[model samples]
Target chain A: MDEMTIIFSAFLNGMGIVFTVPVFSAMMIGIVAGMIVGLIPGLGGLVAHILLIPFALQLGDPLAAIAMLLGVYAVTSQTDSIPAVMLGVPGTAAALATSLDGYPMAKRGEAGRALSASYFASIFGTLVATVIFILFLPLLRALVTKFSSPEFFMMVVLGLVMAASLSGRSQARGLLMAGLGLILSTVGQAPGTGDPRFIGPFLYLWEGVPIIPVLLGLFGVPEIIDLAARNRSIATSAPVKKVSGLWLGMVDCVKDWWLILRCSVIGVVTGFIPGLGGTVAEWMCYANAVASDKDKDSFGKGNVRGIIAPETGTAAHLPGAVIPTVAFGVPGNPPMAVLLGVFVILGVRPGQEMLTYKLDETFMMVNVITVGNIIAAALCLVFQKYLVKLCYVRASLMVPFILAAMVIGAGFSRLSLGDIAFFAGAGIAGYVFKHLDWPRVPLVMGLILGGIAEPYFFASIDRYGISWLYARPIVLVLEVMIIFMLFSTPIKAFAARLWKSGVRSEGSKHGDNT
Target chain B: MAITPENNLQPVDRNQSIAFGRRVDWIVSMIILIIGIAFIIMLQSLPGRATIFPWFITISIVFITATYVYGKYRNKAVWDELYDPDTKDGDEMADTGPAFVLAHRRGVLISLGSFLLVVAMTMVLGPEYAVPLFVFGSLLARKENWILAVLSGIGLWVIIHFVFGDMMRINVPVGFLFGGFN
Candidate 1:
């Protein structure tokens, strides 16, 4: 078939799948669940994704399952702002920037305006990201055809390096966790030889450590522990009496179309990088907003642009993050790492297959993001006042319920008692890691990619011997990219210093001239 | 950084917390180094091809961890910056009052203990009994009202029984005492 015809057909097929009863219904459920989770401080889409994985697996339809998860992923940036605006407690890490200006607005009784502006900005951001994603698909399709085992191996390495370097201030620590993850992935039987490496008398280890339990333990338990320790409601303030200026907020977003577009683009670019995720995107956009504005001092004091920039950027980031995940199986962020795991479980291979045979499914995911965001924004607009109450639900009330869900979710992974034990162990480790400022994302990326990396490593070696390192053009290119990514931070820092010095010199010279 | 209400830690407490965190980091790095060494030792038993990747990873772990430890030791500024609250972004520095710290430590223990207890309970009494009991016990322990705890427990039971048991048809364990239901 012609490219255009294939694209059109895939688009239709994607819409058809999305509109199906099971998929559409599940998406709605996911959207609502995401909103609830997003409103609750400390519990974000990652937790929701981990908790729902077992259920999504049970649903038995990949499209429905993924659509449901994507629904959760897409709308979080919208509802997470609710808590950020109302209570100054960001519901998710990405909402931290939103809370900066959002809380000030709420304190000024423009909570409705800030929220509605965020909602609309998020909607526009997702729409812009979707367009960018669509435009990139053709180019990605062309690029993915050149990938092979050696290239794939290097791609995974590049992803790990990028994640490790960018995830935390300490690249060495991040790499250590990643190395540990790779080692852990070796627990199962060796790929070709079928000999167990670290089974240690446990029969279940033959399949390797289950992803679900580990994910829950690593991400979910730590947050729950922290919340329980804090031992209070998420919101200390009374819920807003009535939300007003929502229309004004929407109008403001419309008037600030250029800002929304610019920030959305920033978000997409940031999102395309492996470890630079929604938090970075939002903050960068917020900084940009502050820098470009004439009355920068007015920011952090109820500036609407502050709300618009971050929200748009963060909303745009989700789809941008999905691109590398869909095209290369390299997750753009931690949550995408979990989503990529689900995609694997659903019998979907990312990379070339996603671009070729499974293009329709990719389009389906895009559609879910688009439709999910629209529904989420509408729901938030209508239920703004009611949703604010979720922020006030006591952590004491939430902990047990979330704990129950975690236990059940972990157990369902393998129907094994061993999984729960693993979960508990991982949770403890995760809590420590969180407190110690260790980056967890690289570890997750390493764990998920480890299984895939090993086989590709062996395959490349077997097929081309060590010459595969230099034999393939793409592999060589990837090697350079990996090295560059490892040192990008220092390079950027050096350049920034140079730029600052140059600017300072120019200013001094100008003063002398005056 | 976002001006959340949670950023209320006193400067002294925050500095102390950072010190404590640095100590923990040192301890964790040492533990990782030891583990990596042990793994390298363990990799000796595997066949050549099977051991290749593990050996690479194990050695990488050892090398990377050693480098991290050495770098931190050699560089005081970097070491300080590693746990410096001012250098960090995203999550606020955790409150580190003595009482809150103790409570936090207790909370971590309870969280882990409760999970393990649930697992043990699941093995002995089955999820049907274990889940509700856990919800009830946890809620009450957390000082929630008894009526609400009971209702929450009951509500959880209905969901587990209906959603997971009947609808999904997961073969939930029926308890060792009651004759395990697989």
Candidate 2:
């Protein structure tokens, strides 16, 4: 009864933050802005978080500031599918899998249906993930305590191994890009030794490369280039059709409630795995949909199941990501890392103490995530009917506006000529990678993991030595998972061949018996 | 069994572009290898513990690049078999031909040219002025309506200035050339 009271009060405290006029207004602004950002290819929540933090800090109330930023972060996953459905350009990495079916649906003039399904699944997934997060609070310590330095290092390795799965068919390219990203992470001044490894003459290198510009260059620029090159509107064949089937789309989401549940489970579980992040969650869920569904071949070809699976996974991972962050002070992704930085700026330390003494804040975070998800989904649904018309806007006209936004957005990170130059370079690199068929997401995953991985790896080695590091229960579990993931592709292939041979043998035996 | 270029990336004439396009992958591999070697060399000055992770990374990069290059030579058939199919389907705008240059050469030049123009302007006139110039110039370059382009340019500048500069108090750089503005 005492525990239940604590839970109830915490929930009320969170709701109080949302109801406060200033915080609620800020959240509304964030939700709307985040939706706009998510509609633009290559501008994701990270960009929004980076752009808004300086402003959020000035907002006076700490809870409000967090609410606003969390509002933005929560909405981004929900709306990133807008562009993926409309133009086949995912606004974020998590939306990449959504484009597989969403874009095809748009091409077929079913944009309204696809968008509606995404919004419904997104809200459903967020609600479910939040409930799971709240219910799992009691088990948090037991689950998180098993993770130490060595375990973190293994998790980083698992992230890299899992990158191969994202390659689709080009596993080698994915691994290579992961290596490249890891290498890029080591470019700045070494944390322990204070040795400037690659700064050269640029003082900016001391802090390492700013991720925003790099991301913009890698993801945003390529899309812009593609848009301009096409020299036409995004939707060629599809007219600005009425959102007639939107109701049916929502019905379809409910009909496929099992899929949403399963993918949400996939997302929440994968979210707990350090370094796997949203991209992996969405991709794994997407792969699951393709593998398990009866109409497997229809994926990447306007299947509503494809759209729902990724959108659900994207939303489900948010609470999962928040769990590790508030409980362990370890971020699940780059934006979450930025959020951790905000925690420090606000003079708050996140960890076990936060879970105990600061239960109200934790609950506020949970409620904010839940409320933010609802508001974002509602806003998208209201505007999607009109926003779907953006597909008819000429690429030439839209490209300039997006480019301006990208430039301004990238500039928010740092005001340096080097930053712009770095973006240009990254843009060139992005184009090359896109052309060469290299898996770009692995590179990004590597970049995200590298900074966190290094210190943990060195600390584990120094404290436990390599042999003992491998012996820890959690580390051993992670190792086994990594090894299995590494070989799972080949194992599945072999099994399929075995099944085929078995069928042939059975047929021969039946013929002989006859 | 030589690596057949992905159909989407292939030029209109495969035989004509293969000579140039096929070399792109090898060249990229060599460049990555050189970068790895350079990093390894740079790490030589660092303390041993600080250098360990970097060293591991650089060596891995070299090993991977070498293996990729060797496979290109020795197991061309595997490369041929493993190459991903063109999944773009009918998306005409998908990255095709030389992704760097792109099919519409003029469009690439205009977009990149306008980007450089914006950077150059920002250095002289600051983001406040440069943003409008970039928006208008790029829109004009795309041959859009003058009134619409101007309105958009001015509107975006207002949003960025008021929101970022005035409200958020983020320092938008005052150009060194504009001494009075600073």
Best-fitting candidate, scored by TM-score: 1
Q: Give me the TM-scores of chain B across the candidates.
A: 0.71, 0.73
lDDT against the true structure, each candidate: 0.82, 0.72
Q: Please estimate how well model 2 matches the true structure, expressed as its whole-model Cα lDDT.
A: 0.72
Scanning candidate 1 chain A in windows of ten residues, the lowest lDDT window is A233-242
How far in Å is the alpha carbon of A316 misplaced in model 2?
Answer: 3.0
lDDT of 1 by residue, A1-514 (tens): 8776787789779878889899999999899988887667667777887788888888888888888888999888888888888888887778887889988888888988999999999989988997787677777888899888888888889988989998877778888989888888888889888888888778888988788989999988888877776666667777556568889999999998999989989999888888888889999999999998999999988899999999999989888988888888888888788888887667688889888998888888888888899999999988877888887788888888888888888878887677777887888888778767688888888888888788888988898999988878898898999888767776886799799999999999999999
Query: Weakest 10 consecutive residues, lDDT, candidate 2 chain A?
Result: A234-243
Candidate 2, A1-514: lDDT as tens digits: 5765766677688788677898788887777777665554334576666566656666878888888788888888877777677667665667878888987787777888888888888888888887787777767745655667777677667757675454535665677788888888887877566778777877788878766677777767777776676566544444334444677679989999888889998888877655567888898889888887898889989899998888888788887777766776556655565676567557666656666678778877767777888887787778875554655567777777776766665665566655666777887788777666665666765665576678777888788888755578888887888878767765886798799999999999999999
Candidate 2 clash pair list: none
lDDT value, candidate 1, whole model: 0.82
Chain B in candidate 2 has what TM-score? 0.73
Candidate 2 is graded, for docking, as acceptable
Candidate with maximal lDDT = 1
